[model samples]
Target chain A: MSPPESAPSIQDKLILLVEDNPDDETLTLRALSKNGIRHRIEVVRDGVEALDFLFARGAHATRVGWGMPTVTLLDLKLPRVNGLEVLRQIRADARTRNLPVVVLTSSREDEDLIQSYGLGANSYIRKPVDFVQFMDAVRQVGNYWLILNEEPPGHVP
Target chain B: MSASLIVPLALSASLVVAGLSWWNVVLHRRLRAGRDREEARCSAGPSPEEEQWRRAALEAAGQADQLRLQLRETQRELASLSYSISHDMRAPLRGIDGFSQALAEDYGDCLDATAHDYLRRVRAGATQLNLLIEDLLSLSRIVRAPYRPEEVDLSALVAAAAGELSAAEPMRQLHWDVQSGVAALGDRALLDVALRHLLVNAWKFTAGRIAARISFRVLETPGPEWPPGVPVYEVRDNGVGFDMQYAGKLFGAFQKMHVPEDFPGGRGIGLATVQRIVARHGGSVRADATPQEGAAFTFSLTSAPAGGEPPGAEVALPAGRMPVPGPGMTVPRHPTNAR
Candidate 1:
């Protein structure tokens, strides 16, 4: 049988990208761009900024018309606030509890994975070192979360 | 005429003395011949069967010596391999941890959240890898450390170990029952390591319990006793006991009775370390438990010689008048109670 038709690409979905590194951010965006994923992307430098963007706190407080992103890509290590704590807060809050939070890190440690899962991370992914591999990971994650999966309506809070 | 008769009598007496001396010589010669004959009978040439048996014994002894030499060589190789793994494996793990940390520090603003998450995981994985390497190294060191046996006040060590465990998690309610004057002859440091591992196991196992009870005591073996030697020190706990079937494998490295999710935090190296330390001291450790009941770890160590004397002495009473039996000191009335 012919390969199943690709589901209608949900290219308009928004993705909240939480990263602290410039090179990684650029690399990720380039990978997504090359994959022809036409989605609105929001970049936050650290866990604190990501929390603010999601909760409309601090700098995002004035952005009154903002909506929740379709998915959040979380890093375990970040300045001022860490990824595990952010995931904990997200899961603890009823408004964001169901929001898909993917833990993407370079850590291959079992403890991190266990802790991340314990804290209710939706998915866990390890960042590859090779440039081509990294790009492939980005594309697959983008395609899966942005196009294939369905998310709830954006929350007010 | 009378003088000439007296001279002839003296000559006859001299001839009698000479004859007695010749008889004594002949008797000595006969006794010598009899002794030689007996010796010859005893040392007669071995039978063919006996000769074959002697040759076989010699061959077996030679084979045994060769096997022993091979065993020694194998042990040496094992030690060397452990050393190399402990030392060589750490450098790469350090690089992973260090570089991950550097990456997070040097580039903080350009990446999106997803990339940052991935980097953080890398760092955590590296740190965890490093910890495992360190634990394995410590285990190897335990195996290699020279075992110097001496009198060790196990009771005091138990108390001290409990105190340290309590300090680690002050909020937990832990009850300790350690008998005083319980001593054993062992490498004090190694024994301490074993006790600490057992105590830590108790602490971790009882994390969810409302009230945790831990005990350390010395039990007297009742039977026809062997040569006076090392005494046994026991550490028991009323915690999340494991199934009895897996008790035999408890001391193996990386042998975990519970899942990581259930226990949350442990590398499962503690009991393995205890086993290594005990074995180095020429002791053996055993575990008995029922699921959800509790676990008791019993180990026998050569009791440190008393009075600074050598081992192999008869047991003696404590110097002071013996006090009435208290809780753990008394022999249990029932067989179940003994456990």
Candidate 2:
């Protein structure tokens, strides 16, 4: 069971953040950094970009020599392919079936909550309007998924 | 050829006969109206009674159509307004609050005390607007969300609200008297919201009392508006009550009677939401109070009445004397008290 020669080491934990709003993206990054998490976070602007990055298709076709992300912070409302649809495709594929996905969005609608869980989201956190609470929520999410949660074995495709 | 075929044939034949009879009644009414028209033509003009009936029917139909159109328009506007509030307005508010916070934390030493105070005010204003937006959304949700009626153990709802209120402020010495076995036929979640608001209102107003008292009990005697045997729930508290002259303004949104210095928190949307929920259940709510005495809110959820209880169940019990219904008492009796 030797490691693949071209694959990045397991010590390099990556976070895939799929968010559309730039302000929310900056705040989230700041929150994670404030919590002392130094993991390399890859930001995708929209649902379409998120899919390309995750599936290594379209603009990300030449993406190589990297392991699957440890966790994906997905936002629900997006431009082309919404977060729910992206999540569906991720679960549909065998390569990223067990990738831990946490749905972080501004929607507190019951339908969104139910549908996200129905589509196999690992966690759901509503973006609080209060900045302090938002920071706290992000802190908890980062602490749990990055440091506490045991990751599934990486599937290199 | 079998008995099943014969039974279905008989049932269908009976249904056809019933439908035909109903049509015959309709035909008879039409024929009578035509005959009356002919008689009017042969004589002078249409009778006053017939003219009045026709006008009333036309007016009712027109009013109904107008109301339906208005309702549709309101719903459309509400959907758009809720979207803008949740999606459009909240993002900017977040930015304001978040950037202000960042500036305060990262560059506090560069700013003077007055500048720090100004930033604090900006954050506070954003936070206040956020709460108002949330409350507005909640009020809209209560109006738009589907109504699901079922047997709700009101006693349990009150006690749970009381528990939460007490847990939040454990230092307060408040006496609770929640009547057990008080039930209602309504949406459980909506009923919980209404009950919590009422309980919270009582809890907030009764803060200054050394021994604050909050009680929830059902009136045994039915009011004039309620049908016989329908229970009217009352949430009473011993606190500083508002003047009855201003009671009309109490349930309106953003109508605060008490000063913020006296009773902090609450955007004054709770009672309006409570009123909306009760109206949805084909019920009504009213408030009664004296300046120094406490306030009492009585409401009736009479759309569908719960099963008939032993008449004496509404008897007021001593404080903290609740009979906690056990798991064995799980089967809640559905509404059977048909008026």
Candidate 3:
């Protein structure tokens, strides 16, 4: 049997990044770093990998200890499983039900925004095309979710 | 033998001459017949049946060509727009702006103020282009989005829009005179969008008024252009209005009547979008305004009569102050209101 879960510390705060485009991934990394966040960011290239990393299944099963990241930066357009489906699964499971998933996408469609909120995303941010605005947005998201906001209680199996 | 040959030759010559004369007569008869037919055609013009057939064929062909051209153009436009949205034309711009920022941040010590200023300009240009792209996307979406039609309470929509705008600027002394029970059969979401644009436009233009008065009510008499029994809804505001000379340009995309200094933050897309949505609903929209008095817009929605007096029963106000058709706001008198 696995050991009991414990409260995560600020120093050990991890960020799960679900992004497909290499350019966006790089920009996001730069933006986060600009916010003075030195936390480890686990980058998954697609939705399938995102789920695998979060559930500790497939390639991520043998990692040292399985714990939810402080927040998940999820991109809506992904390979295999889409962002909305990933969000649905996250909310479906008891273990990750309350995990803070922030939808980061380039879509400004009303339908996409409505669906993202409807599916229980903590926040939906449309990535600004301008770098300065993009940086500011990412900085705010990082500061708010990582430093300011309180995390929900962890699920104990 | 000589006598016999001469007699036969003479007989053959006579026979040949007779045959030639008969052929000439036949040719003359055919030419006369042709001339008569030509003259008859000239005198009578074309037969009605033949003329109709020819006209129908030409018209159908012309229409088909026009439709084909239009279809091709629409397809090309929709394809390019979808590609732009899905592949994201903004990505390249982001790359430019992001890398520029990166350069400035990483190498600030090496660059002069002039160089830094150049970077700022580049970022600003990229940001402006981003806004234009967003506006273009919205315009395209309005055209390409799937339409859903439903019964909409327009009075409620206007009241809600006004409430939101008033809440945004609670300090502004605004008076709203919105008539109740204005219902229409149309797409609720799209109609709501139109109402927002119209009301926001009114709210924006009315910024200078000490006690701004805006009204939403039915025009008692619609012009002859409108079909009978169709209710013409009017949204009027007592604010700075445009000259009637430029009224023709109001609904054009990116067309602005006012200078940026007087009124800013308008991309000039709101009215164009309103026009497109109303046109899509099979309706017509028109506007009239004086330079300083105010602007009034009257429009009719397609399909079914909307916004006449409520059939029976005093209709309850939809969670807002009842629209009093107050006389304080004197909109320019229209020609049709002579009665």
Candidate 4:
């Protein structure tokens, strides 16, 4: 008896992956490629870059009016700002309040899970070490969030 | 005239004595009332026998405090060791698994049949090592981490695990029945792991069977599986059962029973983790099975905290970490060949 979800209006498929570890970054890229996600995948090494990219500040101020990525895969442990703080900043901002943030990390601690969901994360995905399973997880993420899930409001101009 | 003077003096003396005695009575009554009020405010006035027990309890408590400190130190050490193993060992495994796959993909035609088989085996070994490291870390973590006690919907947890098992292998014809409203007071995340392990074991042992009937039912009646009035849970499966004589070895670390040859993908640490979780809750689990007649695991949750206190209306209380054999455990050099 509920209303149907709003369909996505943006044609560009941009995925912003915030990860610091080089090995994991490589593995994630491989998994994303294996899943055939040929979207404009922009990888940021730490939380600082992630915030800058999202908010159009610091180094990324050149693209001030650019639209936000469809899905932001946020990693918890980063060099400068860390993932939880980035998530808090994202939730605090009015422009990116409804942005779909999926926490992708290796930590299975209950503390991290509670904190991620507490910060209004849309989903939390624990990265499995096995290559095959990791690939499958990436595929599911792409299929659901990128392909099926509705975009947040205030995107179309 | 001298007699009259003596009489007045005697009356004065009597008056003085009477006033002093009256004040003494009032003071005595006040003292008795104060003592009685203090007694009423306390939980209970210990009897002579209870007082003696309290002295002995104090001595025992002093000894227990020392043991608790020792246990905490050991837990800290295990946490560090687990970190080293996870970071130090797993990094190489990723390299091996990743590069080998790249090798196989990039240059498959240049390699001979033997070379191809050798690379395949290398990748498989690295994958197996990854699984083993994962199992070791989980085992260490279950013991090292603090407990969280709360009301857990056990039936729903088992159903979820069953759904995952079936989803993992969508082709299998698996029938799992979980009784409704089966609940317990314990850590939710921990109890889920224990339940998942039991279910996974049943699912794994029954791999080749055409008909796999797994049931998770609670014993409503007061039976011997639990105390006179307590209920216990039973996980029954018509899977490949082992001899009862080997049951003693089932809950050991890196157990040789579940080699890659006999079973496809198991490190034999799942049951051990279940045992650790049960022990943390001050509960006990037992297994019985006949070869090919099926196996059943029955567990009763006493759910005592690390302090061994009876569970009251406590919610999500973090228990002190109890020490278990961690870095001291010996993992086989080649787990697949160890069996």
The local distance difference test score of each candidate is 0.64, 0.74, 0.71, 0.69
Clashing pairs in 2: none
Which candidate should be chosen as best, given DockQ against the real structure? Answer: 2
Chain A TM-score for each of the predictions: 0.89, 0.92, 0.90, 0.90
Predicted complex 4: CAPRI docking category: incorrect
Superposition error at B12 for model 2 (Å): 44
Index of the highest-lDDT prediction: 2
The candidate with the higher DockQ, 3 or 4, is 3
Which ranges of candidate 3 are over 4 A from the true structure? A1-13, A44-71, A78-101, A110-124, A130-133, A136-157, B1-87, B109-113, B139-153, B163-167, B170-177, B209-213, B303-339
Candidate 1, which CAPRI tier? incorrect
lDDT of each residue in B1-339, candidate 1, tens digit only: 111332222222222222222222232223233333434544566556445544543443344344334433433444555434443344344445545555665686777889889987887786666556556656655654555667788889989988988998899998999999987766788888999999888888878787789998876761224224445667888898999877777876667999988996688778878876665443457887878878888876432323332221222334332221222322111110111
Query: What are the clashing pairs of model 4?
Result: none
> lDDT tens string, model 4, B1-339?
112332233223222222222222232233334334434544576556444544443443343344344445555555665655654565456667776776777798898889989988998898777777777667766765556677899999999899888999999998888898998877788899999999999998888888888999987673554655445788999998888888998876666454578886677878877777765554668888998878999876663222333222222212222111123322111100111
Task: Write model 4 residue lDDT over A1-157, tens digit each, in one string.
Answer: 3222332324667889998877777877887887898887779999899999888788877654456888999988788899999999999988788999999976665667899999999999877766667778999999898899988764521
Ranking by lDDT: 2, 3, 4, 1
Query: List-wise, what DockQ does each model earn?
Result: 0.01, 0.61, 0.31, 0.15
lDDT per residue (tens digit) for residues B1-339 in model 3: 212332233223223322322332333333334344444554455567445544443443344344334433553454455434644667767887898889999998999999999999988888876776676566656655545556789999999999999999998988999999988766787788888888999999999787789999877888786767777889999999889998998987678999888898887878877876675454668998998889988887652344432111122333323221233411111101111
* For every candidate, C-alpha RMSD to the true structure in Å: 30.9, 15.3, 23.6, 21.9
lDDT of 1: 0.64
Q: Which whole-number lDDT from 0 to 100 does residue A141 have in model 1?
A: 91
Q: Whole-model lDDT for model 3 versus the true structure?
A: 0.71
**CAPRI grade of model 2:** medium
